[model samples]
Target: MPLSEFGDAWPGGVPVQAHGMDADPFFAGEGDLGFARQVVESAERGELFLYPGDQHYFADPTLPSYDPDAATLLLSRTPAFLGVVS
Candidate 1:
């Protein structure tokens, strides 16, 4: 759905949570953070990003895809984000 289509029924006071990474596919509504930052700046907003190491998952530490550093960073960073959106 178009973000702007929420109309008057939309919860305008609700905060948004954006989950992004350095390496990932761009959804139809997404673009580079540089582009995101430009849009945020134009709209007087802020942007958050996660560009940690090649860690793909956090729980299964033994997995070949697990990344220790990225997991740690995600641990430290995601809370503040949830706080912001909640």
Candidate 2:
């Protein structure tokens, strides 16, 4: 499929807590994303990565702990997970 993992393994009822987390700064469409982006960037020929980011999921762009840069740093190590020759 075009998108890996297909957003599975993410339990339900998480948005409730996330709902009150002030969506003002939680634009899910912006930024490189947290570990999810990192794992995606590390995709190899055959590998799967699934994770949930709702309860304590970091990378809230609006909050004081927005970590957009984490994606870039994680991208650097994706090759290893992908089994690339590097």
The pairs that clash in candidate 2 are: 25-62
By TM-score, who's the top model here?
A: 1
* Candidate 1 lDDT, 1-86, residue by residue in tens: 33344342324344433334556445212454445444333342344555544333433588886666666766676677567653
Compute each candidate's TM-score over C-alphas: 0.42, 0.23
Write down the lDDT that model 2 would get: 0.37
**lDDT of each candidate versus the true structure:** 0.48, 0.37
lDDT of 2 by residue, 7-60 (tens): 542334321111111222342334323433434344433232322333223345
TM-score of 1: 0.42
For candidate 2, what's the RMSD? Answer: 12.4
What TM-score should be assigned to candidate 2? Answer: 0.23
